[model samples]
Target: MNILLTGGTGYIGSHTAVALGQSGHEVTLLDNLSNSDTAVIDRIAQIIGKRPSFVHGDVRDTALVRELIKVHSIDAVVHFAGLKAVGESVAHPVDYYANNVQGTVSLLQAMQAESVKSLIFSSSATVYGVPQYLPYDEDHPTRAINPYGRTKLHVEEILHDVAQSDASWRVACLRYFNPVGAHESGLIGESPRGIPNNLMPFIAQVAIGMRSELQVFGDDYPTPDGTGVRDYIHVMDLAEGHVAALDYLNGRPGWSAINLGTGQGYSVLEVMQAFERANGCAIPYAIAPRRSGDLAAYYASAEQAHKLLGWSAKRSLDEMCASTWRYYQTGV
Candidate 1:
């Protein structure tokens, strides 16, 4: 199958490109190089032994998306292009809405114009804001708190409505948890520009001496160690989940929203300790106040993904830390 990934050069998208390529699918990467680096294209080629076709463009450009779909004969799309920082979104709601929601609308419009219906949207677990229960499933209520989560929720609703209006549309909304770790080869990893918003990268930077010390955000949550707890899925596992979703979409035509996670929640201190053990380095840290809208503990049911897509996260927390450290040492 021919697949087009919207943010194909970003962390998860780059890993998924390799997964898809290894699975014998032709991948055309379309990214604007906003938060991602162009060097990822070469890294993917190094790992897969074949380079994916890349377009240096944004998803908000409908004309370019349509042209690319026709030119590449794209059979399906895996949409992952958007602004994804929770704190930043809270500060810049309009930018988040325009880039995430409107960008998705533009991509869908282009796909409709070209009669390309199959789509796998990159949704987030944030949509299940402040989970009423411990583990969230597809049936969990979506009450996005921040602007970023709201954008993802809005796009998901739009996709649902599109699929309902036309039976020809096949949509898979994969709600991902915290995606951490790097490829085993250490060729590609999460390299967020400027200060990292995620925890794992921030920890990695501190371990590598890029940063002075790690800031433990609010060690007073109701979790085990008083810090917040989150489900962190290995990026490679997340990538493979996409491949499984694509295979599940072969003959199916409907909207299916599945959670991609490990079904286990690890507190902030647990992760920091794991990273220290994995990297054999002591990380300096200080306790800081918790950020607003941060959840105490949240994870996924993960049963739906295993039953529907035949996928579950295979990497352990230790492996996540080790792989990330390996990539960090590579300086790429």
Candidate 2:
């Protein structure tokens, strides 16, 4: 299959590109390089032994997307292009809507124009808001707490409307949990511009001595460890989940939503311990006030994804830490 991946140079997209390449599929990476670097394409080529076709553009450029779809004979698309910082989204809601919401509309229109129907959307667990229940499933209600999550929910809603209006389109919305770690090769990983927003990246920076200390948020949560807990899935497994989603979309019909997670939750302190174990050094930390919109604890059921896509996250916390440490060591 000839697959067109939006935001293909970003963290998850880069790993998914490698997974798709290894799965015997032709890949065309479309990226604006807003939050990512072009040198990532070179790293991807080094890992996969074959570089994919690269396009420098935004998903909001409908004509450019249409031309690329027509020229590359793209069989499907995996949409991952968008601004994803939750706190930043609160301050810049319009930018979030424009990039994530309007971007999807443009991409869908271009797909419709080019007659490319299959799509795998990168949705988020944040769309569930605070997680009404532990181990959230596909049926969980969506109530985004922030503008970033609202953008994801909006795109998912748009995909549903498009699917209902057109019978030819096959769409799968993969609601991802906390995606962390890096490829084992240490050639590619996340490179946040400033202070890292996610736990794993921040922990990795601390472990590598790039940062001073970890701040454990809210040591009085309702969890066993008295800190916020989350499901951390390795980037490699998350990458494979995308491949599974694309493969399922290729053969299956209609619209469906699935959760990608390890079905396990870990607290902030537990992650610190895992990183310490992986790095062979103690990570210093202090308890801090909880972030404004953080949930007490939220993982995923993951059963639906296993049954539907034959996929389940398989990496341990140690593996997540070790792989991330390797990437940090080489400065990837």
- Candidate with the greatest TM-score versus the true structure: 1
lDDT tens digits, residue span 1-332, model 1: 99999999999999999999999999999999989888999999999999899999999999999999999999999999999999999889999999999999999999999999999999999999888887999999999998999999999999999999999999999999999999999999998999999999999999999999999889888888899999999999999999999999989999999999999999999999999998898999999998878889999999999999999999999999999999999985
lDDT of each: 0.95, 0.91
Tens digit per residue, CA lDDT, model 2, 1-332: 99999999999999999999999999999999898998989999999899889999999999999999999999999999999999999999999999999999999999998888999999999999977777788898999999999999988998898889888889999999999999999999987888899998898888778889999879999899899899999999999999998878875768888899999999999988998898796788989998898899999999999998899888899999998888899965
Give the candidate number with the greatest lDDT. Answer: 1
- RMSD, each candidate, Å? 0.6, 0.9
